[model samples]
Target: MAMLNKGDTAALVCCSNGLRPSEKQRIDTLADILGDMGIRTAVSAVMYAASTHYAGTGKKRAEAFMELYCRKDVRAVFDVSGGDLANEVLPHLDYGIFIREPKPVFGYSDLTVLLNAVNASAGMETYLYQIRNLTGACGDRQREEFYRTAMGGSACLYDFEFKFLRGSGMEGIMAGGNIRCLLKLAGTPWWPDFAGKLLFLESRSGDAAKMATYLCQLEQTGALDKVNGILLGTFTQMEEEGCRPRIEELVLNITEKRGVPVAATPQIGHGSDSRCLILGRNYCLNLQGKTL
Candidate 1:
């Protein structure tokens, strides 16, 4: 069912880090684009707020998120910022508030922490996508998909491209994104169950060394062993900078002979043309399948 009507409000939240002065334009552009689709925006109060490196204290950020969820006028919540501070707001989140008449919650990168937590605790659908992406080079398609699915209440159509890295026929509930951000759930109450889940990963920034270390840690947690397969998305900075020890190479070494199915796509992650992916849902993937 459609979560929004033509005149309903969709919220833009910054539950991670404060926006830089210039990023405000980016937000405006996003709102204008959505406005063209007849959806009004209700930006969160704490979006531009800051306390040194964060949007605010964890308590404040959590409160802002809860407030948005509780608003009857808000049809959906979209987080617009990405920073290392996202996980800090996790503990302060009142999971119960999310259960009452839940709306679709959307985010990506560090927002992964929020997406998975809500899915695990509240069983509400969450999106692993950056709303700012609507201003990107792929804006047209992004906006199309957003309107068709989120606003129109139609099923999703996978429009990105991918190629297999290990094996084929990887299928299971989608979980994980931005390896570093996902790992923040470790030892926390919100950590997702990995058993038979299709682990998806992408990155906005992080070098080969950082990825190697992250994979090592995740491997040690035995998550790798429990997942049904793995899917790699664009490793933006590393891919653009031509960083050595490419993510695919390191992943191959880390799982050497483990027989985990793996695939990759440059059409997702922080790419200019990145597409959206749904979290906490059963997905059957292949080089050609279009619907998830």
Candidate 2:
């Protein structure tokens, strides 16, 4: 993949959810921020197009994506926000176009479905980051990390301490996104193939019990059996009493028994200091060394 150089254009696409009246301000704000970084921004028509809770109809959203992908000026694509409807646009996307013209696509949360799908179907690399907060006044770190990752510069260092739960040294292609969103692809062709892969799981919201149930579902479906290791990202709003324990116990039960390396950090999901993770890339997760 080529680096996004000065004056390069990035497309701001809204796939899952429509922008609210207040969020329209973010479009201009993000553009200014990108401009300051020597990058230009182009807002997708679907950002303003609405059909109930979705940014637009599936076909409309897919068209917006295709337009950006096919544009000679556009070097990258960023989802404006994540919501429950991203999967609707999946079947409408032309993966063949991406195969011929691959570029970085960025988002997290509900956009996980698209992130993993694009990589699996089109063989393009996707990034996991929160796009909406990248330009805020207090987001300097995130802004810098995004610049570095998107521009193909140095790797974004994860600063949080990761508790090594099992195994030793491990290396595999980094995979996974929002856990709940990933589950949506279970029986579909879009479901990620985790064989010999480092699986990273994160969530924006959910109780421990609910998370345990989701993990159980993954275990039952044999999704947990094929991965080389597991990296747990920040689980926001899931720290209620007994919730963290159940979630940890479930992961430990599955990974530890299998001798799969496992670790956790509160810096990769919905948190303010979330780091950028490049999906479909090879990375080494060292449990004893506490690095990735």
Candidate 3:
């Protein structure tokens, strides 16, 4: 897939939350933003279809996604927003469709389930980034990285500063997403296989103790043991005085014993300047060399 250029059409999909009357206006602005980047946008028919907090019923949301995937003109798909119910639509999705005709799919947060599932089950690479609440250049770097990675460019080309906590260096396919969302898929068929993968974990509004518990779940499930390395992204709201241990300490304690290469950076999470990461693609992380 070449980099999305002028006239390329990207489908705007709302899989989790429904758009309210006030938020609907932002669609036009989002279109203008994509247009400035030389891309055309098409809103999913069910983007605003409401069904008890979700944009639509599970089947309806699945249908919306399939419609975009099968479109001859659509080059990519972008979720309009993230919410708590994307996993509900997972069972209804046709994973075979993604395998047969894959396109770049962009989203994060609640969409983590879909991103990792499609890659693990359907064998298609997906992206992690935001489409909603994009202000003037707030997410431009992320958008550019998405374009580059989706176009088959190496993720290592982008400059990023990382703090190495353990190990020398490692390389593997990138996997994992929003820590909380990922934990939700534990017993499901969509659960990602983290073995021999570079697991990137990020989250918002979680404290050190809560984060440790989440990490413990992974540890007990044998997921952490199989991963070759761990990249901890921004743990927002974790710096409050009351938060226990701090994120760095928690991560080191959890991963150090495993001897997996561990690194942390605030450049790839819910932060204002998060960059796009290509899930299910191979990446080289050199802690000593200060590269990814």
Candidate 4:
């Protein structure tokens, strides 16, 4: 049980048990670093094992996380790691707790499942940003800028750069994370209502065409068409092979054709230096590229 004051951030070491002994050290190191910086952290081996996509870690760990969430000392919550299995925990989680006590929940990639599900179910604000495991990236100016921009807002406002693709700046509730994870939400009850949102999405590495397909699915679900704007965060480090249509081309062509204001690359998701995005809230995206 970790204690955090109003401004203090609480770190949650939710993993999928796929980590090795040395990787555990990495998580511990992260906790220490955050602690040194005055952030509170808690480590739970249960969620680590539960995060594995195919690990089948089960409801026990998810229940444990829910219990931790009920703690009164917790301020902001962040996942210590991402794995393949957070989607499994979504249904099992006491998601109502998040709505009753809204706090920042931060994580990218696999944590997207939890973030999306909770936001949609509870109508609470969540964050799409680096967790304790990767906050060291805060040393970077661009990264820090992204985090601060989103956090500084009283109700989730973003002041990051947006590369204009077709439309202009628009404000709406933000909902999106790892593109792959968003696609996985298809046809699921956990999938949130993305209607009338300022959708933001970023990916690390994957098949570009498949990404397009996923985007199309968002369109089919009315998520894309329902958004006031679309912001594409950093897609970072693509595989040398097996990525087709090229992400840039696919994204640009699709978003432009969809007739939605599209902005790309200001940094967010799965990169050594990931930016921050606030989900399930409203924000204004001003897309510009001028150096100071």
Backbone collisions counted per model: 0, 0, 0, 11
Cα-based lDDT for every prediction: 0.83, 0.80, 0.79, 0.65
- The best candidate by lDDT is 1
Per-residue lDDT over 23-107 for candidate 4, one digit per residue giving the tens place of the 0 to 100 score: 6666777666556555667655454333433323547657767666777776666676565666767668877677778767777
Give the clashing pairs for model 3.
none
Better of 1 and 4 by lDDT: 1
- TM-score against truth, every candidate: 0.93, 0.92, 0.90, 0.82
lDDT of 2 by residue, 87-141 (tens): 9899999999889988888888989999999999977888887676676544887
Best by TM-score: 1
What residue runs in model 4 are displaced by over 4 Å at the alpha carbon? 1-9, 15-17, 47-56, 133-159, 239-244, 255-257, 287-292
Error of 2 at 242 (Å): 6.6
Ranked candidates, highest TM-score first: 1, 2, 3, 4
- The window of 10 residues in a row where model 1 has the poorest summed lDDT is 153-162
Error of 3 at 230 (Å): 0.3
- Model 2 residue-pair collision total: 0
Error of 4 at 265 (Å): 2.1
Which scores higher on lDDT, 2 or 4?
2
